[model samples]
Target chain A: MVKKTSQRISVASLDDLVNVAGASQEQEQQYRYHICICVAAGCISQNSDAVRDALIAEVEARGLEDEVQVKGVGCMGLCAAGPLVRVDPDGIVYQSVTVDDVPAILDSLENGPVEKLILPQDIPFFERQQKIVLENCGIIDPEAITEYIAAGGYLALHKALTEMTPSEVIDVVTRSGLRGRGGGGYPAGLKWVTVAKAESETKYVICNADEGDPGAFMDRSVLESDPHRVIEGMAIAGYAVGANKGYIYVRAEYPLAVERLELAIKQARWAGILGNGVFSTTFDFAIEVRLGAGAFVCGEETALIASIEGRRGVPRPRPPYPADYGLWGQPTLINNVETFANVAPIIRNGSDWFAEIGTEKSKGTKVFALAGQIVNTGLIEVPMGITLREIVFDIGGGLPDGRNYKAVQTGGPSGGCVPEQFLDMPVDYESLREVGSFMGSGGMIVMDDSSSMVEVARYFMEFSMTESCGKCIPCRTGTRQMYDLLSKVVAGEASQSELNLLVELGDLLQNTCLCGLGKAAPNPVVSTMQYFEDEYLERLVDDNGSADEPAGES
Target chain B: MPAQATAETSAADKRWKLVEATMRRNGYRPDALIETLHTVQGVFGYIDREALKFVAERLPVSPSQIFGVVTFYHYFQMKPQGRHTCSVCTGTACHIKGSKALLDDIEAHYDLKDGQTTPDDKVSLLTVRCIGACGLAPAAVFDGEVEGSVTPDLLHERLDNWLAEEDEGNGEEN
Candidate 1:
């Protein structure tokens, strides 16, 4: 098949952008069918790229290259059964496709659906999800600017810049009830307003894509699938907050995400969407990608800013948050990738449309990376207030092989494990905090009865201890001490006094740590102790036990 | 501190030119320290003391500060990697999926712990927090290829095959 270049359009005004969108749509209508193969990291690792190559070659051999648009797209959500291929019009999704299966996929495009290969699209994994952030994820070719334009990608930025004033954009975001998706549930609009109101003439908008949560990949998915969406969101944010420069501090581990962002930025710049005078408005916005060199603490705004400044990612006191003084001491607006992603949609759909979805406090949907023992382990964007049961059992397809659900871990090292009793609990920011966990970058690792709660606590403690930046006494020394005590408990050698000491350390860390990392470090241990006190008691060494026989003795 | 050290990182090396290009793009400022080091490591596979001292001089950063930043980030490695590298995912999902057993099995089988290379300079093993592919639990990257649903036996089998190719290549060289 002929290698295609991303269609670029130079738009000087809103009408020009609309015409570009129309022309892109008209071009897309030429193809009788569209074949989008999952090319996100998850599916790519499953050799979907090679399958795409094979399908494209086959398309060439069949002389149907013009009729069929065989392109690589982003994550299809069901990652476990990738490489997933979706044929348009019929919306038939084929999972676990191989190079050898390429011929059959093409044959089915002409013929009917391959009955055995079809992954039923009506399942809760697809049907239950309400896609706001991920609306154009698997649908649009992330590399193609025309595809994004056709999908109504940058119209929100166009609308925000041309129609509304800076404060009006901020007002819409404020009324939408959207909060930061970067673990901290700070209001996104409030942050925009503060930066907009700040006295500094030189303001910066930083997209915090340094998603360090171990099990989280929401940012990665959004970046990999629809990178221009993030670029558009940042542009809108820059317009609202009176910032002309933007930087995305994404993690280096996600090489694919970095590459996609770089490519998308180039495409945006080439199309006159990123560089100076975007959409012919006097507003000048430029975005550059800065790679995070594998530090989890950099997810913190202060630490992230420090990292971007080419220093060690160490968190300092936050009285002067990033909103006030950030990125070389400028009034900066930093929003999580998912938070920024919500901006364009909120603008297009209107605040009331966004506010009407989900719970009272947490409006809009959340994208979760469901992993661990869950059957449908991939990515899901569900409305807020959706219960953990619906997420784990219905959307996730529950624990595999009929295992009993023990706990579902949210928020990586900083969050807690929710027991079976709270499976029905609505997964919003406030509700998760009530269960001693917070809506951290949306990574839910569902565990079955086979998992030990104490061991899980020890695991998170070890993560915290190892990842500690050693800048603060409370976090550096405290995480180490807590990790040691938890290790002893896991080894069945900890006494009741040691467990009590661990609780005390948790309180001390929460109260005195320098940053959120240290403050929330003890959450997993503390939450486990709260709900599974018996497990700790059972593991505690008996006072009257013989010297040779420890608590682990039968 | 030495002019001779600057002489060693001469502009003729071409590798230093790439490093110079990165610094030049950042206007040779102190803030280019991390990006400079990233380019160094990306080109050389690992950053060394030589690269560090040279970068410290080229950019407006101090040696102590460059060293501090380099060591702070886990992605920067001081030593050269072996011919092949295996990175096991120790993310929450992988840990729950018996990645610990896989790790232990690897240690026992290779007689090397995390961040260690085989004495023959054939393989290096390390652990990463996450590669953000938790859907494939107990995943590991063999060289640049990521394989999922890895068990102790499965990894060992893969290693045997991967190393067997190395052995065949060596035999041909002899």
Candidate 2:
């Protein structure tokens, strides 16, 4: 059983932090086995909590409580095969486990591996990938601060606070080739340096956990699995930028993530890690979570800041970015959850180690939430410059039902479609952008041949149209016009000139729109036209007194 | 005039106390408007005209500003929900997995469109953008429990079971 943490334990020095980790580890040594079950939202939806209960009951009935510790951990990544049960030291995973299989799992813990229930660890889904941000995930109980500390959490904060100066901390980060993981691919250290250099009395750090993409759950999973990592990362960022306050603008849709974050923030505060006088140093920092009401446009930085300030979430012009003036007119530094999650590890290890991982520019691994069509439709983190074919075929296990892969839609509505020709191409920020798709938070939705290319383009256009905040007329009206044109083409009514008009509208939106949402609104349509113009041509009306071409093979 | 619980206000209403507690926890500021509205919707299932006026009185924001903030975000619901809600996920994964067809089937069976409730107020059908539950494609949330890999038959059965249970209770709980 996980020990109930004391109400308040103030840490006056780095040695106190070390002792907490040491004590937790020493207490854990008594148990012979650690039975970890994935209790992330995806697994919880499948009743993993019930499985955990059943396993605990079985352990109690068999008098194995002393030998085995049943604990609820974070997402195991292979959410497709959840509620997953993992046995530590043995390195075995049980997939799709239920209450019925709990007794068998207990028996196998005493005996050997369960034949049918085992999730093979040798598969490319688990292998051929890296885990940096998710190192503590599925291993540590997110609610238990002791487990986190035992796993070497807060050491980075300790190092930053006690040893390194703020400038030195920024220097290490600047040398680390870490780019913003929220799809912008901006250098994170550069952002920190700007905020640090900005003349301000109060600089703030905000972790943009408002993952507004329809299918993306990487950040949600991270927040749910290891909220402390994000917390620690944010606290480090606050220390580096000479800021004492941070805010995580997460969506209200993720109730579980919010709940976990609140609990983790409380534990960190009670343990004297987050609140005033952290690690006995004069450096004091705190974090507050601002819930984002359901508005897709709020994913934009300006709109996100506006929403946090209790107003309509509308994006403003960027000459004076959030670095100069953000979050109540303070010089604010904003990075996504994934970008911050990389900070603790990059600081713990040297920046040169991180710089060696990915391609020259885009360093470190990316957490991609693979959804739709793929067999392994959950979360996966792969090193940068990995091939799309390796991801779709080897890691993703290809499309289910032996279906032919058509194209994969990356980056959500703001991103474009990637056809089969780019399958062999390396997947990095630059390569994805060159292929007409930019990583908008890494939600890869694979498409089979059954999905219509024209309809797919229309679907994204409709999403963009509905989500536009209507602040700028070019975005507000242009998206509606593009959506209308796509709809007409889908309905098989649009003439050749209307098709040309659709192309014109795509160009117009890309150039004149105010925010990132509007500028990249026509990406799906423009990209589909680039790769699959035949699909659109088939949808067009014939001028030779002939009826509309029988659309497609569908 | 200060926004307070007047003589006509429901003093005995315990739900109002929960809303008040959230507002007080947030320090009665204008920024607390969204958080306050969330608590109202959480406790009462939806925000109403009275609640909006009540929140505006406590927080340092005008009623129009509160209304605009509420209306700007889709999470806030102005109208009262039905007895039960069945939320369908129309996300990319769920959509590709034929969630639309499942939604179409539910609409046809209930003779109601998306965001509509049955005339009897038995159940409400709404399409959620995405709950980030793509692992469980073709997902739906009945009440609050998320059921993944949901088919039309499975969805209908759950909704039918809820209706039947309520009918058996005969408004005893209501």
Candidate 3:
């Protein structure tokens, strides 16, 4: 197959490329037959390559290769139904496609329709989704810049660079009400504005792609599926903050994502959207890839920066945030992968337009790596104000096997759990915080009846204890003490005093830990105790015959 | 020349050379066998005990530490995996939904054990922590495709057909 380079447009600079692509009058007609296969890290692990090859072969066998293009794309929101394939321009989506189903799908592709394979109503999974951060995902080929361009990928960067002043861009983002998706919920626009106003000739924009949460692959999916979007978002952030250099602190575990991102960076640079003077304008900006050692704590911005600087992946006390003194003692802007993904849409759609979609306070969409007890376990971009009920039932297809919804754990180990009682609550920065959960990097792990809340708290505490950079007394000793107490609770050994002490220690860690990692380390314990105190009481009561026995006897 | 002895000696020498190179690349002391194996897995993706033994012969650390390190981290694999790896979630939620039965069906169909590769090396089976797709309990990830709400009977047929297709590919490639 000869590579089609004609569709590829080259530009002398980033500004020119963004201008031309943004203002391009000609819109390429949607392909007659478009096959979107999920190639995100999750689906890729399941031999999506074989599925892709099977689909390709079937398409070719049916002599529809010319008319139908089988494109390997990112997560399609229904990860539970992957390796997922969607056939468009018909907008027919197929889930759980195996190699065996290839011939039937191809036969249907030629025939009128395969009623069984066609997804229902695009279903609530796709229908209820907002798709801002994941807008290009499952729609555009991640490796192809042209596909991204045709989908209005870099228009945000163009607008930020050419039209809007740096302050104006920051103001728009600020007005749009976007917060840091990386657990802190700090205003993104405020951070950028701070970095912009900070007295420094040299500043930096860092994309936090070091996603370490066990169930979270949202960052990895975005990096692998829509890398250019991230690059563009970072470029726009750099432009907004008056920073010229940026770094993507990606985890080493995601080799494929890292490779794709590196390739995307190269392609962007080659197209003059990244290197030297961007788009024929004098805005010089560049990005480099920095692989992080697999330290969960390094997901913290300061630790990430420290890792990039060749220091041990450890968090330090933050009197000065990254915006003030970061990355070689320079003003820095650091945002999580999803936060960066939000930039382009905000710029393209405008603050008011973006603001209109979500809740009054939390504007724009939030992309969640919906895992754990959720039917449509993949990635989802939902409007910020969407209630947890909507995300769980409407978009996520509720729980499978007729299981009762227990609780949903958001923001990974650092974030707290929201019990089913709060399921109807709107999921915004403030709303989630109100219910004891913060939107930490959009890792939403749902729990069911069988999942022991005590064990869950213990599990997260164990993770926090192991990953605590051991930098401060509050986090280091507090996490260990809390983990021990949670373990005792899980093992049915803890008394009321021990449980109370766990909560007390959790509060101390939340109040005085050195960085965000240590500070939020106690979220699991606190949230579990708050919502599932009955489970702790049940364990303490000992329904089994060993109530009077020693704790370790069993 | 004694043919068997000579071949063994040459193989030992080759293994020693590979270990030395791996150790140097990993920034470990030449005598650190477990460190060498970890580094090797970091580079090569798995550590067979034979490879571990060969490294242990040259390094000071015992094979037990090498084996322990290999088993410790989820990243390290001891055997050569298939083109795709399928990790089934048998966590409490998944198990309640017949995940064990699904595992049994897959094992019987593939003629493999947990953490074992197929004869053709096209697929391997392992159990993992809840993939966070509990809503789609009884989930199995083949290669990286997460298929949820899986049933034993369905998985059995799926694997058989997938293996057949892989065999066809191998035949075509050769």
Candidate 4:
């Protein structure tokens, strides 16, 4: 029962909208150059806005406003070398652009390219990515809804509403084999099928944008850059699942993302893409954004529901999963931000198209936030079967200053570290599990020889300890005890017996924790011990030595 | 009653009216408790016990329950803020890039631990887990403005500038 405020548009009207939005772009005299500046959060922090302002000012000052249009776009991926600017038609990119270089850049636009500041466009970082989710990210103006519609945004929703049945839409997704990108690799289609078949008039859809992983910013980047894509995806999900109301539970830390998403929702509603009688059909979908209050555990489904329902973000035991009973005792379809972002594409392009991209089991590209000790640190969406070496060495440009690569930590606190021995292994859900890590939310932090593996374990353990919701005893107490032991080990104060006890506690926590947060809390410690035992043994006190003084001490 | 007491009561009445309006706009649904709390905080800068009690009565939840919810979430502040706030990120990327050393520098300067406001209420120092500026390692959020690649010298200069700006605004010397 959605209260539709605006006039409805049919499928023909939606097509008309494409023409209207497109015709305007066509009428505008074709600019000689479109200088796109990367104004994403990563670049904004590095003063890309100033670069944007300066470029615009110089363009105006040079009387090249019509010929050269400078616009702010989303992340260009290679953030380590930002603030970035890309000149289209020529496909020339500039890195570390400053306001002082604005005049020089404008001059270069008239003259030949500036060689010193030009960034190589043919690097593995750009060449390796398959941009399905990020297709319109650095290209379109996210704040403009007409721009989104012109790019065939809501056509999938129209197709689903006009041509395909709900079951047919579900079948297409099931065939695509798109798994949840929010840490847990649950199949997206199966979850949709469950919620769609559930006999509930009042159903809910949730987009979990509570991206709490330390080195991860993929969701935030997507939300800020191309919010309409997520909105369109959610709308399609709502129609397919028979859900009228949706909520995007985003972290309050991401104010920019929240702002952009809010704007997108309003714009979509104004376009009659959301709300009642969508495409003049008997379907209604309204989305509201709920802000997460800085709780990492809220990323869990039940915990996310609890937070949305105005309670402490604590996880409840499932069986009775969100698909069956959730959010005020109604059936709910909860998917991650990235999962929803993948939906419209799967519908527009046939399932066969998406299925052909990745490995036999795991299909499509996985968006990874590559950070830490890597040279080309940024966001990358690689096909599922890509090796860790390609991600770390080829795409990431290897470690900085010729440092020796030690290990790469995947999945944040919930995932494990993969050492150099497994560099050639393909990074998929199964392969990562084989090497003692699960693909948790696509946070790949590369560590070099200068980093201590034991300290890395302690660092992740510390995150779990602080973020645990104190709902279950094992996760709450076990993480604390584990963190204490790790701190002692890092300080060279732990004995051999203490090291043994740490493993025992890790196993205990893994078995007894109430939810995924607790269950996977010990992953970092367990995987570190599995791969880097020599580091732990070196820190442990000798059996013959005095217990007070740790190993390597007098 | 004294005139001063009457004026104080009127101010209190205004705050309650605003809070009630926020609750009403949210359809007075029980699920709007978090939104109500966020609005109240936005108005008052922090959720005081009086405001929490008022919200409990309006939303019809127990005051203790409202307090529990407020305390459980990290974003909700229970106390008043200082003139300026600076938050250093301690995410893994920042950690590797020397955020702890930056935090230590701030602590030494302010003589305060993480999440503490200075005695004179000039500044508040906070240490957050991550602000998602991984590419710009060792980042911080100063009064909602993100600063990346924060060195000790840069942070000190920024803090000094913030203090000077506050002094100019107050039109007084500390």
Give the top-scoring candidate (DockQ). Answer: 1
lDDT of 1 at B147: 83
Could you give the candidate ranking by TM-score, starting with the highest? 2, 1, 4, 3
Calculate model 3's interface RMSD in Å. Answer: 7.1
Instruction: Residues A1-554, candidate 1: write the lDDT tens digits.
Output: 21346355576777777887888788777899888899999998889999998988999999997899888898889999999999987899998999999888888876899888899988999999999999998988888877788788788998998899999999999999999888888998888899999988899999999889888888999999999999999999999999999999999898899998998898888778888898777999999889899898999889999999999999879879888888899999999999999999999989999999999999999999999999999999999999999999999999899898999999999999999899888989999999898799999999988889999999998888888899999999999999999988888787766878999999999999999899999999999988888888787886543342334432
Cα displacement (angstroms), candidate 3, residue B144, comes to 9.1
Per-candidate interface DockQ score:
0.80, 0.80, 0.11, 0.70
Summing lDDT over every window of 10 consecutive residues in candidate 4 chain A, give the lowest-scoring window.
A1-10
Per-prediction fnat: 0.79, 0.75, 0.11, 0.67
Residue pairs with clashing backbones, model 1 = none
Off by over 4 Å in 4: A1-12, A27-29, A542-554, B1-18, B164-174
Better of 1 and 4 by TM-score: 1
Q: Output DockQ, candidate 1.
A: 0.80
What are the candidates' interface root-mean-square deviations? 0.7, 0.9, 7.1, 0.9
Clashes of 1: 0
Runs of candidate 1 exceeding 4 Å displacement:
A1-6, A543-554, B1-6, B165-174
In the order shown, the candidates' Cα RMSDs to the true structure are 2.5, 2.2, 7.8, 4.1
For candidate 2, lDDT tens digit of each residue in A323-352?
Answer: 999989999999999999999998899799
User: In candidate 4, how many clashes are counted?
Assistant: 1
DockQ of 4: 0.70
What would you estimate as the lDDT of candidate 1?
0.88
Question: What does the lDDT read for residue A371 in candidate 3?
Answer: 70
lDDT by residue for model 4 over B1-174, one digit each (tens)? 011222232375676667677678777677788888887887788999877766765675678888889999988998898878898998888887788889888778858778888776778888887888888888999888898889999988977886666454566665
User: What lDDT tens digits, residue by residue, belong to model 4 across residues A165-283?
Assistant: 99999999999999998877889999999999999889999999999998888999999889988988888888888899999999989989998899888877776778888877898
Model 3 scores a C-alpha lDDT of 0.74
